[model samples]
Each structure stands twice: as structure tokens, then as C-alpha cells.
Target: MEQNDHLGQARDVTEFPFGADFQSILSLIGDGVVSTDHTGRIILFNRAAEDIFGYTSDEVLGGSIDALVPTRFHDRHREDVDRFCSSNAPLRRFMGEGREVLGRRKNGEELSIEATLSRQMIGGQHIVTVVIRDVSARKTAERHRQLVASEVAHRLRNTMTVVNSIVTLSARRAASVIEFKEAVLGRFEAISRTNDALVSGSSTDVSFRLLLESELAPYRDDDSKITLTGPDIALDGQGAVALALVLHELATNAAKYGALSTSAGRLNVDWKVPVDAPPLLDVTWQERNGPLVAPPTRRGFGSELIARSLGVHGGTAISSYAASGVGCSIRLPLTGAPPLPQ
Candidate 1:
């Protein structure tokens, strides 16, 4: 009786519809597994499929596979099913291999998915199995990477253009090879320092005080020699870059012929924002206790650079020659600064 009972149990296991362990294996899979019969009715909906589609196996089994497809893709899904039924393609093929496909959950939320389809003839009936993995996170990450790449490219082009202008302008004004080399190297160093500060902080704006200190740090002997008085002001990227060039030119001139060249000299920078309509920043630069100053015979690259530094931003710079030293006044529109003329 025991042998007969064992034989009957084995026969029951063999006659099971899903084979001895097919359903058990499907339950352990991480990716969703779904199979449909020739009539497009879902036949096998595994545990993973239930989780992915937000449906229970009992709710999806024996229903049309269209239940899991988004409305926009229903017609295409049916065409693909018809092709599989007719064996128009290979027996097994991957879907959405290089691109994301759409899937609709039970709650009508659309999601990105990657799927693989396998066609088989089981007991003279056409069966199609699909293995699906959600790829919404991966798609989002890819788009983010593309945007960063495009932004980097734009910034690099702008930087290279500025460098080219510096090289060409420096060469035009240089008196000799040595002068050209010195001018180009000094300007490059100033730009590099500004870039360093810009990247050190998470914000795109740079402090006006920071830009001044970077250019004047080498010449400053003590607090008495160099004075900077102004409220904290932030400059946008283009503003920072333009102001850096202007500051470098002024510091270079002072070091060669003006206040910074003398030990007893003093340099003062003061700026104020008055209650004027549409806010303006008024900055004054004064020098004292240096050799008697006189205007240049003709305006040079330094003067031209200072005048145009705020380029198309509606700012102005003016210089005055005093018996004591050199003085400059600059006015910059703090609000409603316009874009550069294209």
C-alpha cells in the first residue's frame, strides 16, 4: 500500500500543468515574468510580475495582456504579438534593448521598462514569455549626464574665446617678445585665480572683495598700505571675469609706475550703493604719497581694457591725473544689467 501511494503521488506531480518546478522557479526571479497564450490572454503571471504591474496573479491571469500596456502602445503591442504568432522574427528577441519602452501599472502610472520576449510552441499552442525590468531610474540618470556634458561644452567654448581675445590683444600692445610673454602670463594667472575661487564655492557668484584681494595680495604690505571699504557684493560669472581683467590691469600699472611702486605710498578703494532709482554701485580708487602723476601721452591697452571691461553692461570708468597720484571712478549698474550685444 505504501508503494502504491508513492506511485500515485509521483503521477500527480508529473501531470501538473506547470511542470514539476516551473512555477517555483518563476517565483524566485527578480525580473517580472509574464506569459500569454496564442489568443493574447495572460496565462502565467509570476510574483515579480504581480509586484511590477501592481496587480495580483489572480487579477491578471486569464486576462488580455493589453491590461499591462499603456494606451498609446496598445496598437503596437498587438501588432508585435501578431508577428510573433506568425513567426515573422526570431524565436527569441530582446525588446527595448537600447531604448526605454513604456509600461502601465494597475494604477495607470506609466513607467519605463526593458523587456525580452521568447516565443515557444508548447503542446501545439503558441506561448510568448516576456521578462521585464523597470529602467526609469537609469533613464533619468542618462538624461542628467547628457545635460552636464552639454553645459561643460558651452563653458569650455566661452573660456577658449576669452583666452584667444587676451592673446591677440596682449600681442598687439606688447613692445617686445618679453613684454608680450609677461602680459599674457600675468593675465592668465589672474583668470586662473578667479576660476579657482569660482569652483571652490558651490555658488556661481563670486565676492567682489575676494577678486580684489586676489589681484592686490602680492603688492599689499599691510592694512595701512591698502584699504578696501565696501559692502559685500556678489558678481555673476561674466561680471567676475570682466572685473578680474580690469583689476589686473590697474594693479599692474600701479606696481610699475603708481602708488604700489613706492614703500610710503597708499592705495584706497571705496564703493557705495546709494538709494538711487534702479541701484548703481559707485567705486572710487585713490592713490597718495607717490611720485607726481601725469596723464599718459596716449591711451594704451590698459586704459582701453578698463573702459570696456563692463562691455555692454552699461558701466563706465574714468581716470584723472593728480599731482599726488592717479585716481579713477567707476559706475556699475547693480540692477537690470543687460546682456552683451550679440
Candidate 2:
């Protein structure tokens, strides 16, 4: 009887110091902890486990651990447990390993979790402990990042397509070394201006007003040759670049052989957004007081550039000669325009 009392006193002393300590450790853990016996019956549910699965220790302790596993995985999980128990070998611990698994909550909702499994021996009986962390938020963030990357790549490819067309058309028109160099430089300048506008807005869409002013800067002087008349409109990057190249070609042609070549010649530019029908931008460029004008016997670089650029966005340009002067009208589908700035 005396020896029995001594053993009981020893047990009480050991348990007293560890009761609060073990509880504190479990409470401090960030991941859910679930312990089950070799038979797969739950034996311990830590504070984090309760929060994660919406189950109290008392409610889960004597229940099957399979309750916390997704229904689809329960059969395979059972077989794994049986295999481990029969082999008398501990399954590999998964701490710090990024393994994805499905975990079930009290309401039967399945959550994606990263988990670590470990084995412990207590009183000659083997127990398995699982530590689970919810990874749903991380997975969602990764998906969003991937979507943004894909959109950026697609926009870049579209931008390069416009750049390629501009370079090809400009290179074909150069008759002399000096002319080729000037043409290439001119095209590069136009692309730089468009890129600057896009960067300023931090978006693919650019302001139509900005694009026109930038393209006409080189030709604008004391003479009031370039004019704008329209409510402000926005153009997506691809549309803006195409339009810039079209205007450059027109201005270049006029300077070399058309209206802008003479002292009295001037170009009138105007545009409007109609409320009725699908959105349209009607731009008219009329040359006055220039030398006698006639359509080219063969299509030139300027003509091809204008046609191809407009065609990129399903648009067309019509050039006509009236008794007054040569008039060029461009009609573009405004589908490429950006939403009005708030």
C-alpha cells in the first residue's frame, strides 16, 4: 500500500507540471493538429484543429479520423492506415514539404490544405498526428498572378504586330540611303511617342487628342495647318499606334508631293463621334492651294500604309479630288476606343 501511494504521488507530480504546458504549446501552433490511434479513432484535437474543422475536442475525440478527410479520399486513406499498421513502420513525416491534400470541415466543405503527417508511440500504442494548413488563399493568389501575366503577354504580341507592319511598309518606300534612314527614324519616333502615351496612362488605351498632337508636332509651325474638331475620344494602344502611322504617312506624302508642298497649301483635319449607329470616327483631311493633283498611276508607300493601318481595325479610307483640292476621308470603327475617363 505504501509503494502504491509513492507511485501515485510520482504520477501526479509529472502530470501537474505538463498539463498547462502541453495546452499552451497546442494553442500556440498555427496549423491544425489531429491525433488518432492505430485503429484510426481520433484521440486528441488541439485548439487549432477545433478552429480549422469547426469541431470541439470532446466532439471529435473517440470519433473516426476519417471524418476530417474528404469523402472521395476516405477509402484510400483507410487502406493507407491499414498498411502502415500492419507493416509496423512509420510513414514518412511531411514537415516543411509542400504537399497538397483535401480536408473536410464540420459542414462538409472541402478545403485545400498543405499537411504534414507524423507518428508517435505512447504507452506502447502507435498514434498518427496530422498538421494541416489551409492553402486556399495562396492558390487563389497564384491563379490571379497567372491571369495577369497571360494578359500582358497577349497585349505585347498585339503591340508588336502593329510595329512590324509599320517597319515593313516604311522600309519598302525608301528610294535612297538618306530616304531609308529618314523613314526608319520617322517610324521609330512615332512608335516611341505612342509608347510614351500608353505608359503615362498606365494602360493600353491612349487619348486620341494626345496621339494627334504628337503625330503633327514635326510638321506644325507658325502656319495653322493642323486642326482638331471633335469631342475627345480614347483609343486602345493598338488602334492609337495604327492611327499614328496612318497620319504620319499622310503628312509625309503631302509634304513631298501634295498640298503641304506649296506656300499657300494647308490641310484641314476634323473628326466626330456620332450618337446614332455603331461608334465611328470621321476624319477629313482636305488640301488647298497645292499644285495640280492627280491620283498616282500606281499605289505608293503612303497609299499602302494608310490602307493597311486602317484595315487592322476594320476601317477604310477614301481619297477624292474635287475642283477645290484633294480630299482624303478616313472612317474607322470605334470598337477599339477605350472607355471615357471618369
The CA lDDT of each predicted structure is 0.80, 0.75
Worst 10 residues of 1 by lDDT: 6-15
Residue pairs of candidate 1 with colliding backbone atoms: none
Badly placed stretches (over 4 Å) of model 1 are 1-16, 36-78, 88-90, 102-112, 121-126, 198-210, 220-239, 258-297, 306-309, 312-342
Best by lDDT: 1
| TM, every model | 0.67, 0.62
Q: In candidate 2, how many Å is residue 219 off?
A: 3.7
Candidate 2 overall Cα lDDT vs. reference? Answer: 0.75
Residue-pair clashes per prediction, in order, are 0, 0
Looking at candidate 2, the ten consecutive residues that score lowest on lDDT are 6-15
In candidate 2, what are the lDDT values of residues 1-342, reduced to their tens digit? Answer: 764464344334323555778867888898887777776777667888898898997777667888898888888888876665564456756633455677899999887788777775554567677888888788879887897687568767876876677667767877887987788777768777887887678655787778878876766774576566766788876677778877777777778777778777777888777678588777888877787887677887778878988897888999887645678888888865744676
Q: Highest TM-score: give the candidate number.
A: 1
